[model samples]
Target chain A: MKFTRRDFTAGLAVGITAPYVIGSARAQGATIKLGMCAPVTGPAAESGGYAVKGARIALEAVNKAGGILGKQAELIVEDDQTTNPGIVLAFSKLAAESDIVAFLGSIRSTQVHAMAPDVLKLGKPVMIGGTDPNLTHMGNQWLFRFRPNDSYSGRVIADYGFNTLGKKKWAVLHSTDAFGTAGGKALGAALEKLGSPAILDQGYANQSQDFTPVVLAIKQSGADILGSYFTYENDIGIFARQLRQLGVNIPWVGSPSITNITALKLAGPALYGTFGVADYAEESSEASKAFGKAYRDVVKVAPDNQSSWPYDAINVLAAAINKAGSTEPAKIREAILATRKFPGAEGEYNFDQNGDGLHGYNIVKNEKGTIVFDKHIEFTD
Target chain B: MNNPQFLLPNAVMDLVLQLLFTGIGIGAVYALVALGFVLIFRATNVVNFAQGEFSMVAAYLMVVFAVDLGWPYWLSFLLSLAGMALLGAIFNLGVYYPLRHRSFLPVIIATIGASILLANSVLAIYGPQPQVLEGWFETPGIQLGPVYLDSQYLLIIAVTIVMVAFNYWFFEHTMLGKKLQATSQDKEMASLLGISVSTMIMITFIYSAVLGGLAGILVAPVLFVSIQMGSTIALKAFAATIIGGFGDVAGAIIGGLALGIIETFGAAYISVPYKDGFAFLVLVLFLVFRPQGIFGERVAEKA
Candidate 1:
């Protein structure tokens, strides 16, 4: 027990290495930790609820299939409050825990953008549902998308409206938030490429109580086709109601939100006959069908992208961690990127170099309160 | 607001007509909520930041009664207003009464605290999903000539007009209103003159809550019942109060109408993204040029 020069050096070494060795022991004592930033309160709380349920369902399945690294997987969730600042705070709260190796990020692109810097600083792989193309493309290797980005949605919407619907003059309306702004620009660019430039390119702030001016503008523009990127279902509900009320019933094709269960319920009859580029469709594939059944059995409701992405995210993250046989961030990232032709609820998971898992959308219609799948549009380019 | 900008000469008139109707509809909504702010500000020198939350709470109450409990629309409306009236009383007792003798800063801070408490309480109870409350009318809207009038908007406008008329008659002619006015003018003097100042203040809170709740129920079908909905309406209504001259009943209505029209026309001609900016810009301009507000100078600075 006597202290000597060699003993002092040995004690210093033990002090330095103890936390790592003890931390590993502690990590091994419990299940594999996965942090999740979810919207437990605020505007997106309902969708956030669905997302949590999806992750939990996937967690159940993963545990049933023998979880990651021969240990049961654990999911730790923090309320993001569905705000940019909220997600940052939530992610930080999760990041504070040194044991959590990976994270499931927000479905909102803006929320993802807000948390991107922190994700990079954390240097842990985060499975995201944010579809902003720049999310993965922004040189942030830690972030991997579970859903198809807006680029595919924009192209699908434009292609369907032009080639299938046979509409030319278009009025594009979008929310002014990061997601909507990016989606609107993508849609605009896509339409331009299809030789059908938008007659009226309008961007309204989200949660708008009134859409009279927007409806009036669309009416006067004489646009036969409408392409929209609404952020919130409330806005969609209001806009659709006002659009119909104002008698501007142009053939409307919108982003994924248009055909979501939340939007469909809120907008009701007003949203009937509109088209949306959905990332998850029940009939799109067998994986999608299976996800639909699993979700419906657990959630007692039809599955949408909100629930589907998180479900796929948890499955993918767990699968990658298992494939790598480790919780090391770089190994998990490598495993995730190498994943190809993996059947997912969204679609086939073929991760490109940029960490995008899916690169296509299924066209869905609100046919008398039912989201009927139209066709799938996949892009290799 | 009905300015001719990008429309053809023929279409300009129609657009103006439509904008005017829509503006008035939206203006009436602001006016209704602004009246609550005015009533509370008139009675208590401190502005109740919870004034907006009053509408939100009422809307949620409506959802609970009407949608959740499946009560009749009229019964649910009455029950929701009743709930708001009770909340007003509780808010006064819990938040305002204790701080009654304190400085205006303490009281204002208390109201802000109360606002957060109210919003969080609702969030705890109802959750965050925005609920839909169908309008009083089965028919959604009516197309009157060139203008498509939303039924809810029309109902709001009519209610606002009736409220203005009723307020004029009640405040000018009724003995109770005169006594309440006296209490607002000078609580000490009114108390000396045999008016129960505390009772008058309580009535004012009740009326203000009822007014705000009414606005919420009316606009719920149009805006959809959400936590943030009231704050959005209340912001413009607050601007309306300032523009119309703070604490003046008439000024709040006129200011609300003006703000609504300016916003609509501004979004149309000027820029859509800056729609809210136009309202605050007008507020800033008023703060600069006419700081006393449109009606602030009148009534010899009473009370």
Candidate 2:
């Protein structure tokens, strides 16, 4: 009827502001929302599934025990595709959902590094399983590690090989990615500190079809022991088989990936008798055994660090949220940092200023396919 | 690759022999997959980016038949190849046939889309866990003097050689091969000559799919059967095709072998982390210097 400018301006303003107002209201809904970025499609899809399951199981238990802040907790997951860009994209997607109180990040250090900047920008507590020591020390307050960093793992591997196994000459083999490079360097440094430097420090690319060159380099080095940091289970499988086939059998101790279920299944007999510094050895503690049992009943498979770290991360995040009594980022951060002696599937959570939960690693061995717990090595410093 | 700088004389000899054997073995895989790319490019004048997924899909088919269903290995192998041939036909009908009238860019994009679809489809069906496929040989490997010969690698090399011979006889000496070649050269001329150009194109797709499948099946034991496996090999295979001369048969084989050897030796000598870099570096150099490839005919000469 009467087309007035004032009426049109009022209608335009209402339409423009409606979405933000409605979206903000929806963001403050009933359930507590936590976001997670896991490898739902790419090379790490299998482990990513396990991570999701672990987090789900923890959320289930938390909800059963009366939920977080007296409200039912919920988890929102995004497919990281197991790539650096994938995680960054996944993290951004989760961060955009303003209601999410916290996040569970990638187990991969490369992915964690990729998403670290976003995590810092978002200013929310991010539970991570990436073992790269620099992740916590990189001045990112929002990133909290559920697993022990590689520094502890390197030292443990070195200590076990040198003191326990009495192997002097070592060939340090690692992937060239951020995780592997940092791990290799840490192990090399640890070996040097032990006064038995690595005979050959070799770095290979991930997803390598063949490890002949690296294996041959190890063979030629005349090392009595081999310590490795492989990023993928398939690479480990190929390398382990090639190592034995090339007739260069020696005492081998490796990172957590060596003891992974995927690696065990793939490498089979090739990985037999090798030791790995695991962050979640079932026999390490009652909490670990309980989580392992629960995971087996649900997932119908033996639990590895892939599942354990996420399990611990979810549990700790839930507990921290409850302790803080609010969903505020700074309060949650403080609560997470204050968390001490909190029994988790990975280990007792004693988060230092660096946001690293467990300060030690459990050394486990592969006995003919089954991963058997050997010993636990904890560090005071 | 050259005079030993770090290794002693005897050690150098052993190292060279080992790396050479491994190089040829892995190179044979690249050659097989590259052969598929060459065939499709020659036939359709469009790169089938999904060639790698053909191998991956075949591998998963083998896992389903051989591992899951517990069928005989030989039977599974044949059945997997059959399935791949069927997939190839469907891919041709669905992806290429409709887009045949379109420009090369759309067809190329369609192939890439098909690759993503194929990968995700496998992931959806089989789940994400990488499956272990046992090698045809019971013995893992044999130590031959200084070199360790992997039985799977040996099989891959032997199969590659036989395929090279088969491809030669099929394309050069056979009537059907002549028709296929004729169609690839000029569909209109081939159709005018009473040859069904569409049929020739279909056969090329089937054959290329089978070749890609063979490569996947053979290498499954070495590299575990996974969704990403196809894409990884495809990238290197694509590089091989470019270096070998995109449409040349002999070039695919030699180029694959050359790329494998160069990367292996380069990793050993230069830097292991830059192993993939070495492969693409050679590819870049080839593109810069000999754009037509090792066996490709010069553009001016062809004109």
Candidate 3:
């Protein structure tokens, strides 16, 4: 084929751009890309580091076990900075990359809520640890939760407090954030159903320097028991110290944060007798114990819900991807939804219609600064 | 909500006293931080947005020495203050000196940039975990006739009072303090009158940083030493400074205490979730009605 001047110019143009286009395509195909949004630098940065470590561990294990879809999986993390706007920007940055078929979202419900719209727009399955009941039920099909929602935690907290502890009057204290509000509401609903509604339901802003008014309110309420859903560990630490200092020593049952390593360290003796609805109790199950040992060996720290959920999310997502034999968003969604009796570090995963994987919480006590698992409460209905 | 019967005469009085004590405790913290803001603003004619970061860096320094190295609390406290003084000197040189000839806006922006840099640098070196710093007192608190007085809070209030007296004495009596005051009042005139204007500014920065660091070290046990702790307190302290009169020392103290009391009472009587809202609402009201602040004087014409 004899080339004219015009054809020669066209061939030269193709020669220059062809290698660039092909190299980009090859890079994309080399690995199974997974995106993650975490709080690399913010109030939740400590937990975010744990989350990233958990995901990395799971990724290593997945690669060792033939990887996801017969290809080595890679995780690309973007710092959510532990803020709504920060998560939105982080999610958008990850979403802009079309090769990332699935993503790991934040454990904080508010951050997850901030990125929910973007996740829907992308139409890809995103694993999350956020436990807001509304997160799964808010018509966001792409979002799958690895942890039990607040509805179950609320029930478990209320059940353990009212029946086992034999406490009647209750004062429910929670942060005013999305997670805290929903958890508080769910706990209130559960108590009402149990015919022992809380006498004082109080909500306080996050990052509060003092909890005097809150402690005072709880004191005056004359409640025999206290139920709380604190968002940040620092807030919990402050509130717990003040609560005990103010001479109000009612039986306290808190959300998962109460059992967090940070909270335990910060509150110290103040949280000694309190109970928490933990999603990741190391002694709760064999899988949990295994994860705990592995985490302790690798991370050199006790694993909490902050790390456990991400570990479960990564493992579950890999398993679902292998089961589907495809990375298509709908196929992954179906496979994740079909996950049943899947043992995870959090609990036994049985995905419901709303994409909620775990349907229960473990009641653990802060026994002398050590989190001791008391009982596991699973719900079926 | 409190029941009407629960609000008996004794109960009401007890509640008010408790609220007042707690309010003053938290207010003292804001006052300390606000005092830092006031001193720097007075000296440089620029708002040091990094005032909060100064607190944060000092707290981290305390964590490194006291918690990580297991040093004595008293020694760690002194070392942290020393580190803050050095940081203040460097910050003056790096962030303020080059931009000193420029307008106030550049200096203010530089301080903000420095704050971000300081926060991220700490995050990079120490990681993101919040460290627990034990308070100085063995007893957590004491029950004083139906009201609880936290030991740390009592210390904070006492220190704040002492600092106020110290500041008054230092500024009004000492030759160096008079020189610093003169430089702040009229840089050109003070420079002509044989005062080292730059030296006075540097000293002001050092003093402000130490003050900020002191507040952080004091409040670390209560708030926990996290990256966000400084910013959180600083925001409230900034509002306190403005409400107290932007450049007034006494105003900062009063404004901070007033804000602390108002928010505590507001949360108690009105809404807990709107606790921060109450502080900002008061700030907005002050900004609208009394922009010059309670103690600030309005200048009729620019120099």
lDDT of 2 by residue, A45-154 (tens): 99999999999999999999999999899899999989998899999999998889999998899999999988888899999999899999989999999999999999
Which CAPRI quality tier does the interface of model 2 achieve? acceptable
**Candidate 1 chain B TM?**
0.96
What are the per-residue Cα lDDT tens digits for candidate 2 across B1-303?
222457678888888999999999999999999999999988988999999999999999999999999999999999999999999999999999999999889999999999999999998989999999999999888889998999999999999999999999999999999999999898898899999988999999999999999999999999999998999999999999889988889999999999999999998777888899999999999989998899987633432
Give me the runs in candidate 3 sitting further than 4 Å from their true place: A1-28, B3-6, B299-303
TM-score (2 decimals) of chain A in model 3 = 0.93
Cα lDDT for residue B268, model 1? Answer: 78
Steric clash pairs (candidate 1): none
TM-score of each: 0.94, 0.95, 0.95
On DockQ, who's better, 1 or 3?
Answer: 3
Q: Candidate 1: where are CA atoms >4 Å away?
A: A1-28, B1-6, B298-303
DockQ scores for all predicted structures: 0.37, 0.48, 0.67
Where is the poorest 10-residue window by lDDT in model 3 chain A? A22-31
On residues A1-381, what C-alpha lDDT tens digit does candidate 3 reach at each position?
887999999999999999999778657697899999999888999999999999988899999999988999999999999999999999999999888989999999998998999899899999998888999998999999999999999999999999999998999998889999999999999999999889999999999889998998999988999999999999999999998889989999999999999999888999998999999999998999989988999999999988898999999999999999999999999999999999999999999989999888899999899999999998996
C-alpha lDDT score of every prediction, in listed order: 0.90, 0.93, 0.92
Model 3 alpha-carbon miss at residue B173, Å: 0.8
Clashing pairs in 2: none
